[model samples]
Target: MTEQGPVELIHLADSENSVIVRVVGATSAGLPGDGCLIAEIVAASEFANGRLTEVYLLPDDLDDWAEALELLAAGRTVSWMDDGRNPEVRIELKGPYISQGQTLNAVEVEVRDASVSLTAVRVLVRLPDDWVDAHRRKLDQVHKAWPLGAR
Candidate 1:
């Protein structure tokens, strides 16, 4: 896993603003995010002035989020960490972008961290229609790096 560096839990971006979540390491020995294999979550977004927050996300969160991405290729709207404790992401079709010489549907994204300060950023991002495929691969790598109870 070191060869590839950290796993990108999620990367939603556009021309100006972007949101990226990187899985840092495994959670504490006993405590987990409801059987969460991850510990540190690094959230960043240009839209949020600079960085958002480095919170924790349990394995269940990643599992459910992955499931949602699996259905993303079907033109579905999905969300993750929307509980407000962590950086929230809402993705849906918006416009278009050019990738691999093909035009693909864009994703209008909102990366918000409402931690009492009352700040939220919403921006349009151009993501490939099949972006889920890449996302799933990243999640697989994360699981391999930080399996349940492995720390």
Candidate 2:
């Protein structure tokens, strides 16, 4: 029997309970958002021969937060935008991190604005459940070394 490889996961959300998660291959085209690149993840039952049956965007009306949370628990990246109209909150992936066949999981995004300075932004990408404990400890170090603001 052939072993099924790990599924690629990406997630997006907002402060107002909006969330979207997608699973696809490295070469698949990502869903376009205002400033971030997102992919759509449909229900497994709805997948017809490896295609998504539906898609979603931020600020959904339905109460689907549970499902969204489940996807995050399953090792999907979770990203959230502050407000759709805020230009400073816009987040873009930088080089080296954006590569083919890589999966991001449980990414938390916080957007802030200051009077004396530009917007202060924070992004947190949670390591996978199966990752070594040492890797999780590196999260702070990684972000500390990163330059502030979006690309």
Candidate 3:
């Protein structure tokens, strides 16, 4: 995570491909009453680039992400804003773990932009060193920094 910049909503990256879901404007600055954020979900590969900068990442989506880490660690698949379109961020464990505290494992990430010509790219990321904890901490920081107001 970049300490000097804002916390990323979701980030999956490697040398070849990079997919990110990031919020635009302030959380409170979104629609009134509901107050939702307009996020940008981007999928970039060495060959092509796809971006969905108008995706609506609701407050409930943030709540879902907090649970996603748990499901992923438990070998369950999860997706964020997977409305059969947009840049869907789906992640799942590659295989069963060999042992407990196995910080290193394989994860499959898929970034699909069905809204624009249906662009999908999947990558097997070598999730290193307690990825769940790392991501949880980042999520925690984001929640703390840009906490949404009460309904």
Candidate 1, residue 133: the lDDT equals: 82
| Model 1 lDDT per residue over 15-108, tens place | 6656677765544455544444443333334534445444677766877788788667677888777887676777777756677797876777
lDDT of every predicted structure (CA atoms): 0.65, 0.31, 0.67
Candidate 2: tens digits of C-alpha lDDT, residues 47-79: 111222123223221112334344444545433
lDDT of 3 by residue, 1-151 (tens): 2345546676766566666676654444444534555677777777777776766656677788888988876778998667764467888777444445654566777877776575677776655647777778777766665566552
User: What TM-score does prediction 2 earn?
Assistant: 0.21
What are the runs in model 1 whose C-alpha is more than 4 Å off? 1-4, 30-48, 96-101, 149-151
**CA-only RMSD, every prediction:** 3.5, 17.1, 4.4
| TM-score of candidate 3 relative to the true fold | 0.73
Q: 117 in model 3: Cα distance from truth in Å? A: 5.4
Instruction: List the lowest-lDDT window of 10 residues for candidate 1.
Output: 36-45
